[model samples]
Target: MADPPDLAVVSQPADLTNAWLTAVLGAAVHGFSYERIGTGQVSDCYRIAVRYAPGSAGPASVILKVASADPTSRQTGAAMGLYDSEVRFYRELVPHLGSGPAPGCYHAAIDAGSGAFDLVLEDAAPAVAGDEIRGATVEQARRAVTELGRLHTLTAGRPSLIEAGWLERGSLLNAELLTQLYTLFLARYREYLSGPQRSVCDSLVTAFDHYLALMSAEQRGLVHGDYRLDNMLFGARESARSLTVVDWQGVMVGPALTDLAYFLGGALPADLRRAHYDELLLTYHAALGPEPARTPEQIREAVRRQSFMGVIMSIAASVVVERTDRGDELFLTILSRHCDHILDTGALPLLITGG
Candidate 1:
């Protein structure tokens, strides 16, 4: 395969062309057009339909992800290293783990100097995106946890993965940044939070390092840093692939329980989660293999400690992203559910220090 064209500066729909698509996608594209899709905050996603010249040998359509045009969002993408990490993930890691929930990428490229990039991935349509506000059903939750186990187990304790500079965890949750972001979060969303909600946020923010340290002591693996219902696309009832996990920007190597807790925390409503918590944990553990690294009690504690993940994301993400009506509603949904989980699980007590 020839080196693909440099799309280091694709800022609009018109920048894409048949030649560029053909080179990267390894097929002849007679022509193509694109339409913006999704409510993505940090990047713009397009559904591109290709007009194949009869003998073209590539997919009919693919999803294209690029850095956002919005100034703040683009700057955030550049600063946070999201675009580079995602492009690297598709280029390096995805190939090793074949035929899974993640989408198939025909091409993944990043222009490191400009912090611009592109991803042409299998368009899993007729497969709808999951809604964070609506919450997930038990079956959907089951598939999500099972797939997550597969993701974690595939690279668990792999020295190469743990040592990769690009895959190493970033300072997104550093104490200083989290404290600053938490302050901004409280100020911006204070009107929407109840007393208990405010209290939990305050406790978590004050003890951020302590909580993070507790999680760091556990066994580690691949973590979908922002794992949740919203990042997934569900296939049709009869399709072989049940779910496709998207958004690799937040990829990191960390305790698997982080993803597990974050997913269950934001995904399920407080009541439904409470009822199925044990079953869901066991499901994930079973899929992780019989001799799991963490015991049931350890998993329970980690889940309890990490349940505040949604609250942290709700606070941090809302402040950074270009907010809209749906964004507000989605973040609020995560906040409400996560806050309730913390209170219900008595997680706040874990963050408190003795006098």
Candidate 2:
């Protein structure tokens, strides 16, 4: 087969022509159609269905991800280098990752100045997306965490990746911004938030700087900043992988355990998480292998300390993203569970004592 022809980066679904699809897919395309997919707030996603000419072949369907239509969200994505980081993840990092948790990227391109980006990826059809409100089963949660372990294992200790400036980009949600956003979050959800949830938010907001400092001191590795149920797709019958993680726009080099904590803190209801927490942590720890060895206790402490990640995400992302009924519900669900996790694990003291 001949090499696929190069195509310019397309910023919107309307710009995706049959010829462009043909060139990128390395096949003769007859026609194509697209429909929007997902409830993404910072970006847009579409499922592109392609029809190939006789004797030529390619993916029957592929996923196309582009920048958000909302100006505020688009500007935030650009300013935070979210677009750049995702493109780089596909272009630079995915190849070395083998068949890990992330989807296979066919093409990745971005114009940094405009915050416009596009990614053509393998479609994980026949798989159901995990739901934050419904939560995950023990078996499902185990699969997700194991894959997360693989993601961390694959990316750990890579000099090229670690040295890459884009992967190491810092979050824009500083103390000042978080405090402002938290206030707005409280005002909007005041009626919805319980006293415990409100207390968690207030404590975190008051000690935001200290939390950042402590998190910075932890071991660094590639982290899926928003690792949670909503961002994941759990496999079904005939699926190649049990869990396929998507949405790398928030990918960064941060505390390794934060992803584990973020996922476990909200992916399961509090009671189930309490029952299976050790087994889940052991599953992740075992899958992570011996390199940069860590004990179960160490993992527990790290996850405990980093539990505030979910709280921060709930406040910061809820304020910034375009609002929807589902969005509001999802954010509140995340906040409530994470607050329970924080209180249950006694994580509040860490923030209170500035450790």
All models: lDDT? 0.82, 0.86
Number of the predicted model whose TM-score against the real structure is largest: 2
TM-score of each: 0.93, 0.95
Worst 10 residues of 1 by lDDT: 1-10
Report, for all candidates in order, the number of backbone clashes.
0, 0
lDDT of 2 by residue, 276-299 (tens): 999999999988877646888999
Q: Which candidate achieves the best lDDT against the true structure?
A: 2
What is the per-residue lDDT of model 1 for residues 1-355, given as tens digits with 9 covering 90 to 100? 1246554445556789887787767888899888999878899999999888786677778999888988899898888888988888887887777777888887787777778787878888768688889999898999999998876777773557556877776447788999888788777778998898888888888888887777677666777788888888888886547899989899987765888889988899889999999999888888778777777787788788677778888989998989789998998889999988888877888777511
Model 1 CA lDDT for position 140: 90
lDDT of 1 at 92: 82
